[model samples]
Target: MTRNTLEQEYDIVVIGGGTAGPMAAIKAKERNRDLRVLLVDKANVKRSGAISMGMDGLNNA
Candidate 1:
């Protein structure tokens, strides 16, 4: 096994990408249009965590 290193910079880095992680990233972007926000997670954000498979249970409000 090998280790890879990443060198980068971001104004905001959200660690989870689950339930509210993505939302927080969005909100941060909305508040500051110039910010560079990065949302990271082991799984795909499209259908990760409690939602599973799809974004069906997401609160629309």
Candidate 2:
């Protein structure tokens, strides 16, 4: 396997892909389009969260 390194600079770094994390990142960008915002999550943001996994299934079921 090959390893890669990434270097980035951001004015705002929001951790966690859970519920509020994405919202916060969106709001920050809305407020300042020029600002650098980074959103980091342990798992895939789209499929990893209580709302996506639990609530979605519960509602559909």
Candidate 3:
């Protein structure tokens, strides 16, 4: 297996690229444009979580 290490400084680190992860990241940036944000996930944010299919049924979740 391969190993990876992240040594950069970040103001915020959001785990889970799921339904709410993206929103949180966006809001953080909006609050402070100079903030360093990182979104980590095991899968692609676009095609992962409940949104994998689309944002059509987001209210249901």
RMSD of each: 4.1, 5.7, 5.2
How many backbone clashes are present in model 1?
Answer: 0
Off by over 4 Å in 1: 1-4, 56-61
Candidate 3 residue pairs in clash (backbone atoms < 3 Å): none
Tell me each candidate's TM-score. 0.68, 0.70, 0.69
Q: Which portions of model 2 show Cα errors greater than 4 Å?
A: 1-4, 53-61
User: What C-alpha lDDT values do all the predictions have?
Assistant: 0.69, 0.71, 0.71
Number of colliding residue pairs in each model: 0, 0, 0
lDDT of 2 by residue, 1-56 (tens): 99998998999998866667767888898999999988776776447755646554
Report lDDT (Cα) of residue 12, candidate 3.
93
Worst 10-residue stretch by lDDT in candidate 2?
A: 52-61
Top-TM-score candidate index:
2
Candidate 3 weakest lDDT stretch, 10 residues? 52-61
lDDT of 3 by residue, 1-61 (tens): 9989877999999886667876788789899999998877666545666564566344122
